[model samples]
Target: MAGSTLDESVTAFLKNHASNDAFEETDPVKASQKLFPEIAYTDTEKAELSQWLITASHVGSNTEDAAKAAERLSTLNTHLSSRTTLLGAKPSVADIALYQHLASVVSKWSAEERTGEQGYHHIVRHIDFVQNSPLFGLKLDEKVHIDADNVVFKIKPIDAKAEKERKKKEKEAAAAGAVASGATPTTLTGDQGAEGKKSKKDKVKDKAQAAGDAVASTVVGKPGAPEGAPTKKKEKKEKQPKPQKAAPVEKPLSPSLIDLRVGHILKATTHPNADSLYVSTIACGDPPGTDNTSEFEGQVVRTVCSGLNGLIPLEEMQNRKIVTVCNLKPVTMRGVKSCAMVLAASPRVAEGEDSHKGPVELVNPPADSKAGDRVYFEGWEGEPEGVLNPKKKVWETIQPGFTTTDALEVGFDVEAVPQLSGEGAEKKTGVGKLKTAAGLCSVSTLKGATVR
Candidate 1:
């Protein structure tokens, strides 16, 4: 019988039966007989469907294995093309099983790979037919359209009821915890009273205090003396004076937690999907020092995606030595994956003026410094984070430290020029000087610019 007719018959038979013990069968044979008691298949047809299921399971084992399985399925599909089903003319268990297997495998294949010159048209047809049949239990709205081949296929639908229940349970658990802690349970939207409100800084402080309390509990025993017994006062030890040791010198503050390196742009191109972005391949040299086992130690070609399309002309990008954040996580801009970020400084636009027309200059490296060389402030020495998580606010904290001076020295040192009161009197007090490692990344041009 046709799949629609079979579905109708199964529905009608199930509707007519109302026995509570009908689903109590536990044995595999008994369960199968109870569920599909009327549907019967020949031994040869059953064997063929079993073979197809076994073959489909091995589809993605490896390239060779997948190709072999595809070839077998293609041949089988070709043979069954003239028939409505895998066996004879009517849809059967064999047809359903084989169609399901094909559908499962097809979802994994890319649109181009699914319908190429050597594609299995018959398998695709069979999948489309089975998915549209009443027995599939899939709605038309659930089908996704593949633009490349103009084929519509059903994707796995999410269980909305289960998801809702999971979220509800989570909310209940949070509410319970809040009640236990003597705090009012607030809605997920956080529209609590002003008395319960906490700023971001306040929240961070609370978290830090909680962490400190946990650490203190681990280190020292719980508060108060052990049960009973009067507490004895301990005598303090006498202080002894010894030879004074040299005071430890304070280290300079680093401008950023980012691993800024000198890199030479090897290739630059406008991003196909975004007009404001430029995709460039940069060559950053290996890590400094010997015996380094870091994977990034050797010469690395990092793909950098930047929004300097309008600011920097395409021709000027070639062989340009630019400062790059070498340790940033790879991000996909448009369709291309970028592994690094180029550094540039642009002056802040005046209240009434546009900043785009202002001169945006790239931070220049020292003439002696080569690609891959680490850029450090004058007094600090340490490695940058391998990869910075923006969520941690590391970049946000150090961004203000990067600035230029009137003298055009492009470094991290903040210099303050004092107004002259008198010739004899001291001119000004030096303040706000940024302390960086010995080496500084600089640019010859001194126009006021903001480093990004």
Candidate 2:
């Protein structure tokens, strides 16, 4: 009845019962054709079905293989959207073979590999239909629960004594083997020879004797005590603590250290040596129509170099109003000495984005503010240093407070701005407000930007 041939007889014998005539075809494709001859398949459909069968049968063997199968099936499903089976209109040998193969591997696939079920909707639908068809009597068992705590873990406890003995024995055996091979055995010391040969009880006795000796050594009065018998506990001379020096107070950084001033870019040109650098002559000191009697009465042009070649266009740099640190020590870059540092703000680069390039805009001051006008917060003043030391970290203390609001105003923390009065003076009064020599310097063309 179960012979591997298309013409095999399926015989049935029963008492007082008629024999049923049946034929068995071991080959599924041949059987499908013989049983359902009405379901005709084209040559192309047959070839495609064979490929799908091979893929489904071999898929889920590994993660890589499963991914490939999923992609292939999804693509096929997309191409054959409205069709019920691999071939149009009716189920054929191809459908039966594919369904059987897919059903076999579907349960074994991991969650990532099973995405094909959702991606290939038509294929999933066909699979469901074939699995539930009356012609096939396949009954899958209900899913079982696996209790994690029920697992049995096998672990061997470590025995230090046994390990030592095993190693010693291995060494002795190796030496004996070498001697048997016509090599002379090396003589071992008494201690080395006794290492593997000692009895368990003798080792225990030696351990007990060693522990007793250690206890006797610590006892104040013992029979075999050393010459310093009844060891006198040296009275810890109550540590007359030396007068602890008071911690040196850190000097507060004066706000005047930052010589913030408004400057106009008089002429901008590319730095000759560096590609991503720009050298510009900035006009500082005093604007036109102002008092021409002050120390910086006339416009003083200072050379400034900035790395803004690709960030801003050269045409826009001309006559642009910018904030500058006038007191920072001059540094030679690309053979040109940069006297002052220009201030600019850039948006914080988001996580996972390329940080090499982004928009960098100049920090703008008020329109009416003249070049050389000092920028300061109200109620905050200090003896501004002529040149800041590169090592003093004067800028490091104040740099964190620099920020910009959505309004594009570039400023610092009002609290961090050093008060003009001493520590004894009113500390809380006139705490928060930004100011400059001309007026409050808070306004910019670029909105929602932060000053770096």
For each candidate, the alpha-carbon lDDT, in order, equals 0.55, 0.56
Q: What is the C-alpha lDDT profile of model 2 across 1-452, one tens digit per residue?
A: 11222221111111111111112434434554564543455667656545554554443234456668657667766544535456554455445555544654554544333333354434544565445432222233422122223323311222345656988999999989988754432235566555535676987988899999889786845565477679766788787879989996555675556888888887899999999899988876521222111112122367789988999899989977888888878888999888888878776567897543757877777666656656664444544676777898777666545656555566565444344333545654333233553355554465544454
lDDT, model 1, position 116: 56
Query: How many collisions between residues are there in candidate 2?
Result: 2
The per-residue C-alpha lDDT of model 1 at residue 125 equals: 53
For each candidate, C-alpha RMSD in Å? 28.1, 34.0
Question: Which consecutive 10 residues in model 1 have the weakest lDDT in total?
Answer: 288-297
lDDT per residue (tens digit) for residues 1-452 in model 1 = 23212232223323343122322532322322344343355666655544543444343234456668767766765554334455543344344445433555666666545555455544665566555543222233333233434533322222345556988999999999988865865523445655257776887998899999998986686666666969988999998999899995533334445677778887798999999888887776532111111122122366778888988789988887788777666788888888777878777566888756647777777554556555655543354665677676566655644666665555443332111122345443221222221234665574556566
Highest TM-score: give the candidate number. Answer: 2
